[model samples]
Target chain A: MSRVVVDVVLKPEISDPQGQAVLGALGRLGHDSIRSVRQGKHFVLEVDGTPDEAELKQIAETLLANPVIEDVELHLTKD
Target chain B: MRIGVLTFPGSLDDVDAARAVRLAGGAPVPLWHGDHDLKDVDAVVLPGGFSYGDYLRAGAIAARSPLMQDVVTAARQGLPVLGICNGFQVLCEAGLLPGALTRNSHLHFRNRDQVLQVERADTAWTADYAAGQRIVIPVKNGEGRYVGSPADLDRLEGENRVVFRYVDGNPNGSSRDIAGVASENGRVVGLMPHPEHAVEDLTGPSTDGLGFFTSILKAVVNA
Candidate 1:
């Protein structure tokens, strides 16, 4: 079995109130170097075998992330 | 006709949806999220609530439930389906409708009586009103701001898929004041407002939302 990690993120143009709130908290904690912070979803999928990148991209685009408001990044990770 | 109202874990409006269906002269069928069957309902209603406890994202978890697969199939086949509040979020997550409902830009959960204008009256759930007709209904949600791709919004506008538009101020920072939207075929509708909460005068709000339920009954009969 192979493991694939999918990272889903909101587009830059979309307003992320939750992320902004997190940034506010970070500022309160004295993280001066970070100007902005965006939140995203991460999913690890157990695949049948070593699936090709196309298959992973297809799964991310079609099911894991909504293309209307988010983008996706797929990578293979080891156990 | 029998209208199916699906109840997911944490659902708060299934009973109200079923009541509205019965009031609209249709038999109300209770459907469950884990069930794969729809029981041959004439229409389906995804009622409001914090499904999956709004985990991951609002309605994101419940949208992928087994019952939603059947609802998606029926919706594609032109079954009248209404998604209210959290259900609207589920519809977008399920890809049965375009656009996504993000957290309100104001960073607050808004609950109030809202007025909306009917953008298109030909849809399965809006035929009871005239185009541009305004009605007051209850609007409530934390993540009700509607966001969509620019090109897709243009396409929806060009094709008249924008079913309901906010008449007053934008309640949740939704683009173009969009309160609700319909599928291109007009059989599926997703709105952030709690129409089921305003179906009757006894509930306090105007009975304008009853039109949504009645329209679906009429559509099923005509079909």
Candidate 2:
């Protein structure tokens, strides 16, 4: 099985309202970098078959991330 | 005509986009974001959704998808590609079209039926529309504001590339109330509104949005 890790991050200067909302909530909780946070999702996919790293990277580029709003990092691990 | 709708991992509207293409009398081809092949589709539609879960920016990461490389090549070769909402975000990230879509100044997720004026009927996806004709379509997004440098905006205006403009109100604070635009070749078009949802009369405020799909068919046939 092949496993892939995808990291998504927002662009600089683009205000993340969702992150701001969380920051506000966190401040109320007394957890303070918490000045603001940009919200993003991370995915770990385990493919059943052997797909080359190149093939997997293709999927990450086209399907997993949109370059305008998010940047993605792909890491492959063999178990 | 064969239409390809790219499905990114977080893409929300691939099914709806495929349905819109089929309803418009074209074959809908489901293309994976990872695959480099376009599957011999004549046209492509980048549907709305929070691709990559709107992770890095919105459409930023998805613009670099393996399939998008092929998309960029095909688009340059004259294949018509339409980007709606987040898809519009992807197109700009890919540099397939000019300008960028930013967050609304109001900083909220805005959703509503928006009226737009068809500003450029000469484009491939807008041939069925008449200049200045008002059409209603759904606009929904948080980072939906359209932005560009003043010089570029002037150039777009001078070059007549502005395809659509908000008619009644600017929902996302888009510059010059711009809602949609097309590439110089007219083969690549992107808009902040959701035209796919408005194609069916039963689900749509009006059937005017179907004209965008039909316009591409006609453009493909005539080309």
Candidate 3:
């Protein structure tokens, strides 16, 4: 079996309110060293066989992430 | 004419949507998320509320529900579809509309009356209103900000697909001050505000929202 991991984040130009709130909270909690925080979604998919990158990309673009405001990176997390 | 109102498990405004349809002199057909058929309704409404408990992102799961397949097909075939709030998220996720509704820029769940201008009066949902007509309706949601690619935003603006625009000032900081949008063919519309909630003067800030229902009724009758 193969596993696919996808990380979806707001496009660099788009504003992320949740991520900003988290950054603010982190600063309040004294995690000042972290200069920036952009929250995103992570998903792991276990497939019956090695999944093709093109197919996975299709899934990521069409379902896992909204292309209008998000960018996704897909990786084979495990084999 | 009959209007279909899909009621997912967490749908909070299906009844209200149905009520609006009835008030506008159309039969309200109840549709379920588990079902695949559209029940032959003249038009369909994906009402507001936290469907699928808003799990895995608001409207994410509901957009992939079985019924959406039929909804998408019908919408493409020129059947009128209106999505409100969470319904708007579902539409965006299902690729029925442009843009994603992200968290409000103010990082708050805004719930209040909002003024909007009818930017495109030719859509299936806003035809009753003239272009630039101002209307007040309830806007309520945690994730209501609209975001899209710059090219897409420009294209939408150039094509006049922005059916509604925030008046006075932007409410949730949506791109281009957009409050709602219509499909290229003007057969589908998705908006963050709750028009169904403002259909009655006794229960809401104004009855301005009745135009949405009446517009659909006119479309169905004219068709």
Per-residue alpha-carbon lDDT of candidate 2 for residues A1-79, written as tens digits (9 for 90 to 100): 8787887665654456678777888999989747767887798989887757888777766566655445678877877
TM-score versus the correct structure, for each prediction = 0.91, 0.76, 0.95
Identify the runs in model 1 with alpha carbons over 4 angstroms from their true place: A1-3, A26-33, A44-55
**Model 1 CA lDDT for position B57:** 79
For model 3, what is the error of residue B45's alpha carbon versus the real structure, in angstroms, after optimal superposition?
0.7
RMSD of each: 2.1, 6.3, 1.5
Candidate rank order under DockQ: 3, 1, 2
Instruction: Give the Cα-based TM-score of candidate 1 against the true structure.
Output: 0.91
lDDT of each: 0.89, 0.85, 0.91
Q: Report iRMS (Å) of candidate 2.
A: 4.6
Residue B59 in model 3: shift from native, Å? Answer: 1.7
CAPRI quality band, candidate 1: medium
Error of 1 at B109 (Å): 1.3
